[model samples]
Target: MLAGIGLLAAVTVGLTGCAGSGGSAPAASGGISEAKAKTATSAADFGGMKGLVASANAEGHLNVITLPPTWANYAKIIAGFKKKYPKIAITSANPNGSSADEVAAAKSLKGQSTAPDVFDIGTAVLNQNLGLFAPYKVSNWADIPADFKDPAGKWYYDYTGLMSIGYDSSKVSTPPTSFADLLGPSYKGKVAIKGDPTQANEAASAVYLAALQSGGSADNIQPGIDFFSKLKKAGNFLSVLPTQATVNSGQTPVVLQWSYNNLAFGAAGGSAGNPNWKTVILPGSALGSYYNQAINVDAPHPAAARLWQEYIYTPEVQNLYLAAGAYPATLAAMQKNKTVNEATLKTVGEPPANFVQLTADQATKAGTLLSAKWRAAIAG
Candidate 1:
């Protein structure tokens, strides 16, 4: 849901603070020689990023999917990559697509020049498509949390956030403080969601938060589905893609989405004259999760892919993650290295002391349930 609308919907530019999809098989080792065609898990294994960078420069291109410039400040990330590696050109597709779409591209575009070299995926989708990914460990591997990465180093979390309510404080006299408050009369015809929960990971997380607040747990999300049903029946729910434009125009004044997205949307449109846009991760719904990053098994530009991974996990890139309001995976390492700026951390906020993190299995179950019941809930 961290989107810069239309930056690259058909072709454009684009967390982990939550759970995701995955498996463990350590990066090929134990006498696994570094063949020229082999995927490099680390720059050191590939003779270093300098060599990888040289090879990638020869290839001169990288294809990425589902990245928008505005999402996590990817505009800056992509621009940085291009400037840093002037020879390697980057083109993205399906900017508004989902984690499922990233997996889909890895499968659908195999052997094509346009195939994605890397992926940013959700926990469930990551687990479901582990076979499609190649194991990779960046130079900053030690900086990442053990729990946030694959035991074998196939994939790892980049950043994360919690589900929260974004509202134009000026439009709604009193904003909702919790899930139950969303159902009150003050919010009718005002609340909107990102997309159908069953299909989109962000939407699905919002639904999970609702379920948790409505007497459900990771294993059972029926309460969330039921809550939305009541929301629809009460005429408070609108199935709109909550973008910055929608918020600016006051068409969808209240949105349920990730805190980073909400905060970004509010910041984009809020001014001194109209400074009431706010984000609230209620006491009842502080779910923390993160998205994962991995290389495609059959990436068109393998060397470039490995180099990209190395660059992203670097300290400078990790700070960019914070600049865009994401808690980077290297947070602790950055702090320890005296590279982390405490003031910058404030912008992204701290991970909740009371947070609900879904496991890969729990996410799959919730996704299935949401798929089966979401459309009927809103009759959408």
Candidate 2:
């Protein structure tokens, strides 16, 4: 999850490290020119879905970055796409990398056959690297809210989850109810943030949520930094980047992460090693954020990349995200049309109305502040 607009704002907004010049072939010697796919703004540009599918089938591959199988049910989503289009093979790299890593990978692999075709990134990173994305709208563009996508189609939100506190019940008799509860001695050396705030959107959102809880707003994140400083000083803030294995092993017993991720871990339960893992969204501390999806400007498999955008935006795929506990970008439309999965709706429910989200500007500013202050404030 990355910095995005709040629900009120229509609830808007990878790791690759390296730099490379993205280049394109002069023309396709065969069918469905790569140059044409690179410049296409919609399926209509390719003569419609049949033409687009044929072009993509000719390309035969899609390279993606920073998509972990376990996160937000990507495994099943990927499988579903494969089932739908067996001709297009999907290759995902650096599944655990941050948004920054995605940018780096784009640069490093530019013009190569293995270069990523699309990106799933945070709004903060998206704003900072706007030049890298190509402008292309999906078939269901109208279904997405105005605030959730760029008018030019450079990027659009894919799915979202609320910020939450996840803890191991057996390890801590008193589960944390709020950010203040984390400062007590019982939680010393137990709490962990997902990743480095300066580089990872999840960690940045965790800070953003803490800011709200500690007398700060979207534009003011210093309080959140100060709150973490206080936690560090009290020996309760652990600097480790947490993962599923860490949570299951009790290494990072208390973690600040997205609700969907925590819920997934809890669902894994004893079978995955941690029997008492639980997730909670603190009252009055609701914070929601969505990750944006974009096509790489110099994607190696241009047609395949565009096809991927078309495939994922379908209501069926959106419903897949819901089953994984993530609220899809087309959620409102799904609900209005009664296309959403009722069972999933009953389980996860809708996003909180009061949750606050940051606009692109707010996220960029907050990210800058974190880059400058986060490390020094929480340094051990």
Candidate 3:
């Protein structure tokens, strides 16, 4: 749940494309093959087949639009890409607004004159606007996990964050350990959530976590609603969404947030002396949601977009994200990235010892049921 500056910066920079393999075999999930990786690595020698980078530079520069304004690390990532393709210039335009704003921009890009070369969007937006993407499977596409990419190769997830609970130690001695703990008397009137289930990603995370805790499947979300209803009855649920400032100031003691956001807050204000904050990934819960990147269907600089994507998914960049408390999607990169210290991994809430990946269809169905159930629970 890292918020604002650090989280967005890490996500933006860390979300580069997958790396090319020299001789490594392709993963079953449709990642980059060894041969393609070598070709991409030697992109400068590709001659007339200059790929997206050449095309983008020919157009003067590559244009990118993103939703996360706090993505301060964009410059660093862009700099890295520039080192490889010096001729390609990157122009970034971040329209600060909701997912709806990104969707609007995607639609706007359909027009030849107004189109951007790349886009970064939330999971919901990516799935909803699959049409805006051009499905040119990257050379490293085989390396990416199937669950992380679109079936049609439209969009792919680079990093992920778990929806977790944050607690202010000054306000309470024992933080909630499990989902049931949130319903306890000590936490009554102390909890704050992000959004209504139907409106926000964080709200959807809450539902997903509740469903997991209650043993509900994608088709059954009653457990999630029941969990929320219990909290509502106890008058424990604070309906307002907690912000970075509010959490850092200790104004709201307990918040359901992304692990990255919580970690960022803790890094800023959490210490041994005051020890103001702490975050915990509730057991028996799924990773709440993800943010994704995609190349525009008619990108003016397709090669640049591909290169950018590759850079974002590399071990070095992924580690940068891990440093900021977000989880990288590439297992190889995660294993190779030395910057991802053990402490940071613990804070970011790595997958459980025995984790199960969810299918897109399953996630969609689960989200739908959970939304309905959450509404009923909140109402009741």
Candidate 4:
């Protein structure tokens, strides 16, 4: 039987400001001190997180470790979770600089006292560390398509985002329609891409997209390397991927990034206040990947973690992620809800007209091979 631990409440203070407004100082009644009133205001400024406080009280406590330097607007998700489960205390930690850092964290949690209850990992990492996870088939498991989850329930994808090219409309009159176009003379030095596929999702995505373009399966990434080789030869490859702020600031005209990143950037207002930054889906590309969530095998608060899982999979939470430009993992959830804005929806291309979905086994095999071949091809 799962033993319930003593409830301990701790708040993970986010960068976002506190939730409520403060009232004016009360008039002193019978010589009450002004300092007390000032203290009251300060308390109001940083006093209570009712949601987090309540969650900690009711569901024990939760510790969620994730890839750090946080994503844009992730605070909203954390705040939303607290609102729904105020009794579940959440503590977030980031040890290593990149997603690779999570590996060390997972190892530390093994049969030890300091393991995280929840983990947000990349697909590649998920493939490598399935043993670290505790399999709890989520209540909404049936709703998720077979392609997006682990059959034994070790880990499940919460959301999927495609990697694509974002082009500045002002500089490039015609967007490149396919991978071949990226190698053309006109596009030389016009593309900025994040390098180091071994350590970066964006770089891995570039390899995946290239494989599709070159008739390579996700399991076979040689095509991706060959594709990049040509781009490198053309001198069109930019050293680093552009950030949302950089893209919005118009520092780079063309960038390879996740679709959600492009959507979020455009919604926040693009270059020159035009909101015209656009992402195009490359035809025949195996470029989509998922950001997955898993429960640690030694979760300190399993019940609370499960509750968090249920909450995130709900239509409400799924839609919230969608509104923020993430693609919901459940097709039924997406169809039943209408939270993604029209302008944002318009920019998201339909899955390539004749695309094929990769099975878990296939994706793992392909990702591994592709990583190896990409290194060789790029070095050539």
Candidate 5:
């Protein structure tokens, strides 16, 4: 549940699922393996690659939701998945949808082909929808920290990024380096957050970072809310969510978002597709957190859903997450194996030494407060 935890992401079977033959196996009743599919909690549950691959390819596609290519270098991850498993077609929906939106999609799209087969969301949202996740443990399950994963293998923490300020160097003469700089007269009508704090994990993290800077702790978030309310009163806060288009057009000259988000936008955003944007650090506040990944419990393509999770934890893919400024969940294991990409580390550097991380209880408490107070605090 820490800030940068981008709660975010394969198999083969030798034979066609029972759905195809219906001889002795009816696709194992919602699973592609000869074993019951719905009861599969991990890749081991499947008999072998022959069944998993064939069953997954038989299902044909993976429906993932809310995976913006810019966030944590997901474009590469998706591309890699397809390359590794050429048969499974991967489809992404709602690139701009939030953690809350993902849970809603899983529940609301229960029996549909469109249900997100996999998810990358914050721990707060993950907690609300635990029962909806199909319990799954990756091949490298031992590599993940105990505290970061669910005991039942339902969901696990994936990566972490810090909250940061993204700026267009050409527009602002003096780029704000501190949280206080955002409230200055020059920033009026120029600064924006990724989304509404009550609904978006990134936006809510921004509020938490502001609280840290505004004489508050995880126990008290009012100060952060007050800081934004002040920005609203000064006309400095624009509700429009920051996007590559918005950033390039100067609509949102400054964006308060995750460091990975800011860096990704800077590297690939703009009219010419260049890294013209810059990310700045605020004094003494690194809102570091990890996001969670889960599989839809009732996913139509259960085999494909499980495959996606396995692929994401691989060393190469985990490194892809790092190249895009995210700290992958298997980082510690990678370091031990001497597979930690030093070059990638230099791009993002070590996270701030002075950082604030909310405990499970603190985050749960904070979520309640944010949901109840965010609207009134920003209203006219």
Candidate 6:
């Protein structure tokens, strides 16, 4: 769910299985042996990036699902990939689908030419479906932190954002400074999360954040559920999913989402977007989470799938994420090597010093609890 940012409109996009082999049977392309390219862990396996690109071009198609154009500057990234490798045809599907939808698509489309070549997903969902991923390290694998990726490269962190409150300034005359403030009558019937917490990472994280603010620790998310139940009871929570159109129209006046998403909304807003949109980080509430990228083990276009992975990890694409207010997974490496855009970094600013990124176990535990309790807790 990573909310795919603001899906503006549906665009289609949509992982799996081993350190070297799962069930992918890539055909020989550009003279590369079928087995060699199919099992390539790194570009060096194909001799280098040049060889990988050639093989991918020969295969000539990438089926990505659930990647919304408005999310994390993906439109430009997709366009850039096309410009860089024109021979590779890209098919993007189900742009606004949730993380669960991504998994479902991969299952239903298994063994087909149109199955998702890659996935951009939440950690919670990815962990639950690990068998679906293929382990393949990118060229810059060493640069990624051990904590952000699986040891076998089944999946790796892509970009991330901290939880924050976004509000239409015109509608919220007195800005809320904390989760507690959101319950005030001034904000009644105005607050919303990104999607169903039981099915979406962003919404789930919002609940986690509420848990932290309402006396629960990372190990216990019950307070978050209790808090939402209270919000609903107070008539301060809106059930509708907020979008660009909703924000601009003043239908969804307040939202709980990632900093990057809200910041993007406000930046593109003020006139053509929201007339007075603003994003705020509530005091002592910096819950951060990163979306992950994984190649489907049963990918129809194996070579192209790996190629796309290599492309996104490049400095150009990483900076594109930063420009859109997201913190790329390679940010630490980029900073050390002085490759990051200084201006963009300054514009994006630093995340709260106390930002809390849940461990894999923590996310799993939370998702399980939500799956069981979220519906009943939020039901009217």
- The TM-score measured for candidate 1 stands at 0.86
All candidates' lDDT scores? 0.73, 0.81, 0.58, 0.57, 0.76, 0.81
lDDT of 6 by residue, 176-196 (tens): 877888888999999999899
lDDT of candidate 5 over 1-380, digit per residue (tens)? 22222221000101111111111112533335433566688776776655666667667778888888767777777877877888677778888899999988888877777777788988777776678887888888999999878888998888888788888888888878677899999998999998877778888889999998889998898899999999999899998988878888899999988877776666443333324577766767678778888888787778877888888888898888877677888988898988888765654565556767776677778888999988898899
Worst 10 residues of 6 by lDDT: 11-20
Worst 10 residues of 2 by lDDT: 6-15
Q: How do all models score by TM-score?
A: 0.86, 0.91, 0.70, 0.71, 0.89, 0.90
lDDT of each residue in 233-274, candidate 2, tens digit only: 999988787877888778999999887677656643224435
lDDT of 5: 0.76
Mark the regions of model 6 whose C-alpha exceeds 4 Å error after superposition.
1-28, 31-35, 269-272
Q: Of the candidates numbered 2 and 4, which has the greater lDDT value?
A: 2
In candidate 4, which residue ranges exceed 4 Å CA deviation?
1-61, 65-75, 87-98, 108-116, 249-251, 269-276, 284-286, 333-353
lDDT of 1: 0.73
Off by over 4 Å in 3: 1-51, 58-101, 108-117, 122-125, 268-275, 285-290, 298-304, 333-350, 370-376
**What tens digits encode model 4's per-residue C-alpha lDDT throughout 1-380?**
00100000011112241122112222223222333322221112212233222332443455666532224235556677767666445666652234556667667655443456677777776777777776666566777778677787777787666666778787778887887888888777778765467665556676777777778876667777788878877887766556555665666677776655554445333232225666666655436667787876655454455556666677666655554445668744456555434343343333343444455676577667766666666553
RMSD of 5: 6.6
Q: What is the Cα-based TM-score of model 2?
A: 0.91
- Evaluated against the true structure, the overall lDDT of model 4 is 0.57
The weakest ten consecutive residues by lDDT in model 4 span: 1-10
Superposed model 1: Cα runs more than 4 Å off: 1-38, 268-276
